[model samples]
Target: MTPNPTNAPARLGVQLQPQHANYTQIRDAVLRMEDLGVDVVFNWDHFFPLSGDREGLHFEAWTMLGAWAEQTERVEFGTLVNCNSYRNADLQADMARTLDHISAKGGDTGRFIFGTGSGWFERDYDEYGYEFGTVGSRLDDLAEALPRVKARWAKLNPAPTRGIPIMIGGKGEQKTLRLVAEHADIWHSFVAPGDLQHKLDVLARWGEKVGRDVSGITISNELSRGSLDDGHADALYAAGVRLFTLGLSGPHYDDTPVRHWLAWRDRKNREAGVGAAA
Candidate 1:
């Protein structure tokens, strides 16, 4: 289910890409991010390194998410965007349900948000022995898979405490945006500020045509130093975006950008007269 936007003021999240960092460092960074008031944390699903040294130590995403579920107390967690091609729909649903149970630990279970995308990284497909079909075919697979995922979630023995939120990430207008309108609780994209507004306009149009209210769907965009400073966040926020994610890469896991964004997030919430839930 889509979360109530009015419940929290806008929230800030960080993605700790597990490409270069060791398990200890990655775990420690998540702890620190939670302490520093990040509302959500995530890691990408990939077996090999995405940057820096190609052969750098890397970890599987869902396994790391299980570890994270046990480690953090206040922060919500999930894959920044799990590739749909990597796992079967039922398996992904089961994994998400298990993570939800692990994170909730006898409490409320709305903590896990399953952020996924139609796979794009070709190298992952080649290395993992999955068929790397055309983009259209992959999107078709994703379209078919989403319903099966939802069905499996319902059929699981211990159902998700609360329906786990489904976040669909991509900017493809025809297929991706249509799927977002039909199935996503959250929609993530990386378009520029100007283009974001236009794309969102299109998304809303699609939602209206499908009789869905796009207003309930959270929109997320990646945060970087220059991009955030270029009025991208402000523009997107004005365009109905609420959840903002900053990607942190490497062995260092520099906190400077994260700190700056947190400050910015707080200020924005204050200016808007809303207290964000931690």
Candidate 2:
């Protein structure tokens, strides 16, 4: 395993689930999250509702991403984990590149990160006419698709205005971690503290085998607090888990936790001696 970094710690983020929110609400929430000091803002890619009404007001991921690019100024943006099985690899790269351009309209192109995973949600594929294959087969497809995605980015007419970060999300050790080492600029997993540590160790081993520096890849996970004193946030942070994300539902988009998380983000940044944004 590669040695762990003892440098400055990780940062915080939020996953704004777009299923429950209308376009106006999501746009407002993105602006609010930026103002609240979120380092990254994410939206999951799924056609149907993950929670609430099964037929709730839903929005497509990439198109909403274009809107997010236009609306937010400072917050980094991307899908939490776009299913690779849904779209062709080259097309995915093109969409990401286009979003990169859209987000950086005023010279901030590095604001987009393409966070993707092997497809698991069958409903998305079934309704969309995508091939819903076995998990192993899907992983195989993702493995094959990633190289083509990168190569297509290189071959695009304008190319991406910046090197848009590639984030691979999953906890499958043999395939996913190896893929992270091979292709990801960031690695996202939902494992808890102890499990997350183990996976990081595994990822480091994969990194070494692939001759890649694992430290450059940011580690991210989801977060929620029932109360302000919850120890979950601190524990994850201490474990070298930056990019903490809180999921938000809509129609009633409560800003309470969002406010608290921003406060936490500022405190962490201060402890690391990074100047708080004014």
Candidate 3:
């Protein structure tokens, strides 16, 4: 088994939930986040609002991503976890490639992270007429679709500007962790600080079984639900997490949380002898 190093520099990400906000508001928020120096900007992939009015104003994920590709110049962006049930696997790959190229300006590589997962929202499935398969079946489908997504990237005419980083979300020890070991460049989780160690241990075991090293995979945890000052961020950082994400909702997208986390990120990075934006 390869060494599982936990020395990566701290980075901050914000998930601008695409709900309760008009497109113009969303667009401005994206620009503001980039200007605020966030390392990554993410949006969730669901058709309807995950919170507030269930039928409130919301926008599509991939389309908004395309606009984000055009709007932001520096921050890497993508779905926090795109639902695999909505589109064909091959089509998803192709669309990702197109977005990759679209984001590339001047000579810079595309700042797109292909974050996805086996979807779980039953409402999305019911309203959209997709098969609301059992959890096991959905995992099976994601297991199969990932390879095709990667293969299609290789076959695309221009190809992606960079080896697009794959960020997989979830922490199921059995199937989700296994898939993360096999395919992910980053893994997003909501596990609390105390449970994070066990999750990482499970991920390591999966990596050993799959002949892959899990150390290089960035660990992403959500900050939207917790008190950042409770020493949770410090504990998570101590547990080898490098990428921290905070979810922001609208009609009023608050920047207080973002600024607080960004300040925390800078402090952590500086303590580790790394630049805040590095």
Candidate 4:
């Protein structure tokens, strides 16, 4: 019999955009998501909303994470991509370790994925008093921060329940992919079906340059609007993406589309017949 690939099944994640809603609403939404059998739940790291109103109600990422760490019983969760510019690397590492422990309730690899990226939103930087550095500078900062993050994890009082998986989100081939090859356990992007192979090729080259086997790194693709077309998912699946994320806004995130995505996840898992590690 053929061995089932370790990453055979595709998984679904919900990006609970923490905007335009109260904490209770967000909390209830997460419970509802868990009931739907979503594999993961995510919230972005930003001080303000990325869409709709600029002054919409939004909660902080890491703080809310602590609550999820305690509240969630089954679903894995984390920042869709935490802004590396906002916090110290060591502190970030410590916080992740603590959350990892909190999430380890009966006994499981603590369901916390540390998804992060270089800061991009100008408003988050400006209003939050963080420096709005150039793109190059931010990427450089992330490259430097990752090592410190790992180092801190090593020296923590109580280590993480399991080595928290580090996921880096971005598509820049030069610095970003190189960093992914060096440090990330997963690489996230919005590459279309047509461009997916090329990006994977670039990532493979980066792995060779860094002397790391990146075939193990998970590929996370966005649930884009245009990607909603028929056969769109098939093309992406054929391209080797296994972790899909759906972005939803608060005040009232539409649940109809979410149900569709969850059903797709179930069908994909049933067909694959193995847990999708990616």
How would you encode candidate 1's per-residue C-alpha lDDT over 174-252 as one tens digit per residue?
9999889888988888876677767877888888887887678887877754344727677767666678888888687
Clashing pairs in 3: none
**Model 2 global lDDT (CA atoms, 0 to 1):** 0.82
The per-model lDDT (C-alpha) reads 0.84, 0.82, 0.88, 0.86
Q: What does candidate 2's lDDT look like per residue over 1-278, in tens digits?
A: 44235354556667788877778888888888888777788988999888889899888888889889888888889998898988989999999988888788566565898999997888888888988989899999999999999999999988898888888888998999999999887788778877777888899999999998887787777775445644887887778776777778776567798788777877776787756632
Span of ten consecutive residues with least summed lDDT in model 4 = 1-10
Model 1 TM-score, all chains together: 0.94
Where is model 3 more than 4 Å wrong at Cα? 1-4, 224-226
Output candidate 4 Cα RMSD.
2.9
Q: Largest lDDT belongs to which candidate?
A: 3
Q: List the residue pairs that clash in candidate 2.
A: none
Candidate 3 lDDT over residue span 1-278, tens digit each: 42235667788899999999998899899999999989999999998998889999999999899999998899999999899888999999999999999999999899889999999999999998999999999999999999999999999999899999999998898999999999999999888888888898888899999999877888888874636573888888887778999989987788888889988898887888875574
Ranking by TM-score: 3, 4, 1, 2
- For candidate 1, give the lDDT of residue 48: 88
TM-score of 4: 0.94
Off by over 4 Å in 1: 1-8, 225-230
Per-residue accuracy of model 4 over 1-278 as CA lDDT, tens digit each: 11112355788888999999999999999999888888889999999988889888988999999999899899999999999999999999999999899999887768899999998999999898999989999999999999999999999988888989999999999999899889988788888989988888888888888888887787888886523543777677778888888888988877777788777777777777766433
